[model samples]
Target: MNDHLVILIRSFSAFFILMIIGRILGKQTLSNMNFHEFVTAVILGAMAANFAFNEKIEVIHLLIALSVFTITSYVLAKLFLKFRSFKMWTEGTPTVLIEGGLILEDNLKKNNMTLDSLNQQLREKDIFNVEEVEYALLEINGKLSAQKKKELQAVTLKDLQLNAGNAPQFPIELVIDGQLLHGNLDSNHISESWMNSQLKARGKKLEDVFYAVKGSNGQLYVDDYKDNIQHPIDME
Candidate 1:
C-alpha cells in the first residue's frame, strides 16, 4: 500500500472513532462542559490527532488513552449528578460579584478577574454602569449572570395598568423548504384549503415557498425561493 493511502485510512479511522465516542458521551459533553470535561476533550483530541498522522505510534495505545479519559469524564459527570457535595467541589459554586448596587471586589479578585474585565463583561450584557446592577453572579462555567436594578428594568404592560387582550401564541412553522408540515397545520387548527387559499392570494404555489410560518396574529409569513431583488447589498 502507498504511504499516503495508509495515512488517509488512519485519519478516517480516527475521525470515525472520535465521532462514535462523542455520540456515546451524549450532548452535555459538548454543551457547557466543565473543567474536567474540557480537559478530557483536549486530551482525546490530541490522542486522535496523534493516531491519525503519526506512523510511529501504535493505534491501540491511542485508543486506550482516549477510552480511559472518556470513561473518567463520564464517571465524574455521573458522580456529580448523584451527589451535591461532589458537584460543588468539582464544579465550584457561583460567586457573587455584585450585590445591592455594589461591586464585590474581594470575590472578583478571588476569581482572578480584574475590575476592567468585569466592567467589559457588564457592558456586553448591555449594562454600561455597575451602579445599574442589583445583582451579578459569576457562574461555574465562567459566564456572567446579571440582574438590573428595579428602576432600570424594562417596563411591561402590567406596570402601566393596561390590559392587553390576549397573549400572543407561538408562531407555528407550517412549511420548510417547500415541504408542507401537515402535522403542524393540524395541531395549530389550520386547514389545507386555508393554506392553499393564502398561497393563491399571494400568487404563490406550495413549491415556491422556502419557508412559511403562521404568526400569532393570524398572518402568514413567507420567504420564497425566487430572489426578488435585482442587486443584493450587504447590510452589515
Candidate 2:
C-alpha cells in the first residue's frame, strides 16, 4: 500500500511489458516510429504505472492492461505491413523544407516548424548559411535531409580535368589498444618490418601508442597519446 513501493513496481512492470511488446513489434517500431507509436508508448507507460506497485492492484489487472496494449500494437503493426495505404497514413511522408535554395514556407507552416528551427537544423549539419543548401527535407522520423549546393559539394579529380594512373592507397592499422592486428596488416599487404619502420620515424614505440591506423596511401598515423591534451610539446 506504500506509495513509494507502488511507484517502483509500476516502473519495473512498465519497462518489462513495453520491452516485450517492442520486441514483438520489431526494431523498426522504435527506430522509425511515428507520432502515433510514440503516443502509444506513453499511454502504455501510464497505464502500467497505475497498477504496478499499488497493493490494492493485483498482478492480473496489470497483466490484462499490458496484454490489451500489446495486442493493439501488434494488430496495428500487422495492418501497417499488410496495407501500403495504412503505412502511409500512420507514418506521414517527408516534408520539403527547402528546394533549390528557396525555403518552402507553406510546407514549414503546415508541419508547425518555424524557419528558425529549420536554420538551426541546417547549422547542425555544418551548413551555417541557408543559401548553400540545394535541398532539405524534414523526414517523418524528425531527421533533416540536406543536400549542399553544387559549388559547395566535393569535386572529384575528374571534375578538375585531371587523370590519375592508380587509385590512392589508404593505410591499415596493425595495432590498436596495445593489441597487434595481423589481419589488418595482411589485408593491406603490409609487413611487420614496414610497420616498425613507420613507428621508429615518430620516435614512438608500439607500446606507447594509444591507437594507430595505416592509410591506403601507405601513410602511418600514430597517436601515442590522447588528443585535446594541452602539453608544451603539443603546442610546439
| lDDT per model vs. reference | 0.84, 0.75
lDDT of 2 by residue, 56-102 (tens): 77778778877787788888878866564576688877787887678
TM-score of each: 0.64, 0.59
Q: Write the per-residue lDDT of candidate 1 for residues 1-236, one digit (tens) a residue.
A: 89899899999999999998888787888877778888888888888898888999897888788889878988888887656568879789888898777899999889999999999999999899889988888988888998887667787876466434544344678887687888888977889999999999999999999889987455799999897999889653
Worst 10 residues of 1 by lDDT: 162-171
- RMSD of candidate 1 to true structure, Å: 13.8
lDDT of the structure predicted as candidate 2: 0.75
**Positional deviation of residue 173's Cα in model 2 after best superposition, in angstroms:** 40
